[model samples]
Target: MSLPLTAGETRLIVAAADAFFPPDGPIPRSGSEAGCVQWFERYLALSDRRQRLLIRLMLAFVQLAPLLLGPERRRFTRQSAPARIAFLARASKSRIYFLRVVFLSLRAMMTMAYLSDEIVANAIGMKADTDPFGLGGQPPLERMVPPPTPQASGVRLKGGGPAVEPGLGDVG
Candidate 1:
């Protein structure tokens, strides 16, 4: 297994999938599915080997899917969106093409996860409690985690000025 994802990454993916695919709902979800996570794990392993191949596989998958499904007006292939998803999932599970397919699938999942929350949050006009990009302060937790000490937190580290300009010294 690959190194565990950071809590923030997990939170982001979860939130996105929840927003994108409601429980007992029609739309497809990412990372929330048991297989999606497994797909990501497998892909991450492959990425550790050949990163560029990931991109190639994704492009190939998209271009080949429609043709492979044939122009039949069947239930699966009739609708383009879901069919593409199903096809990709199945391909990602293929042992022979597992590396390539997994890479594409994970990349797609991550992309979807990165966007879902923001899109829903915007559609409903709800402001995000935390930055979606995970660049800001931590989201709320059950209990407060203590802040690091000045020394450990890099408060006293010199050779540079404060990260932000100090406002007029409040010393009265």
Candidate 2:
């Protein structure tokens, strides 16, 4: 299935991803070169309508945010790399919680798409750890750390009071 994003929207996504995960050092390629936009398109195609709409709205907001918050009133994709990075830095710390959330969400999406690429993963040695059929020297489940004992920590109720266990606390 095709993504619902427009050409401009797609460009915005690519620009944002490129700014967040620049093709520097170990990256070897820009987010656009690494196929971040295509990854996002595939993700959106599989997502629910509401999720797709939310992501689209976030992209629109990011594209237009530079005009409102930037020193120069330009679209985000039109800005220079440094300018784009500055705009994102400011947006990530905005007093508006929703704006911060949107920035973080976009950053996460871009980072995930970039890092999850087979080339990137292999370069980072993650590909070396995979044993799909458990044929490798995997640790036994019993060697794993046990779950924390709930009783060791004080359990608090939703309203911030300590949880009163039945029969453990004084009852009428």
Candidate 3:
């Protein structure tokens, strides 16, 4: 629900995030429970139309990955916990090059969101607000998706400037 994606897409993303970073032993809070969905919502809210579409396509592919596996046609969101885990493990290590990329991308996204949680970050030695600027309170997506560079009055509003490292560009 937090994600800007469609209902089904949001469900799929939540399911995927939970599967990717499920609780083990003492680590409480699955990825979705740790605010991964909300993280993704902020991220997508800043993405351009094309980027959002590509992300949705990747999510769709991940949702349908079971079909690519075998006769198990159940969508990713509907699968049991164990089955979802197995699918994610297999997809991430898949021999199919693009499948590996897609699955890895999903895993990375979930991991980033999961690590953004203060509890997990502290546990893992990542300071949440160590920065003097209080950047830790800002969504990571804000840096990843900066505001567009200023354009001329009559410009057609083309692409933004080149990609940048986080917090590197000056908005002013």
Best by lDDT: 2
lDDT digits (tens) for residues 1-172 of candidate 2: 5466799988898888789878784567778877888888888999988988898889999999889876968999999988999989988889989889989999999988887788877777665446666656646674466767675334556576667655555566
Prediction 3 global C-alpha lDDT: 0.78
Q: Each model's TM-score?
A: 0.29, 0.72, 0.69
lDDT, each prediction = 0.46, 0.82, 0.78
Worst 10 residues of 1 by lDDT: 70-79
Residue-level lDDT tens digits of model 1 in 41-138: 45555565455355334434444444644453333323445554554455556565644554466456765443344544464465755566554565
The segments of candidate 3 whose C-alpha lies over 4 angstroms from its true place after superposition are: 1-3, 24-26, 128-172
Which of the two, 2 or 3, has more lDDT? Answer: 2
* Pairs of residues at least 3 apart in sequence or in different chains that clash in candidate 3: none
TM-score of 3: 0.69
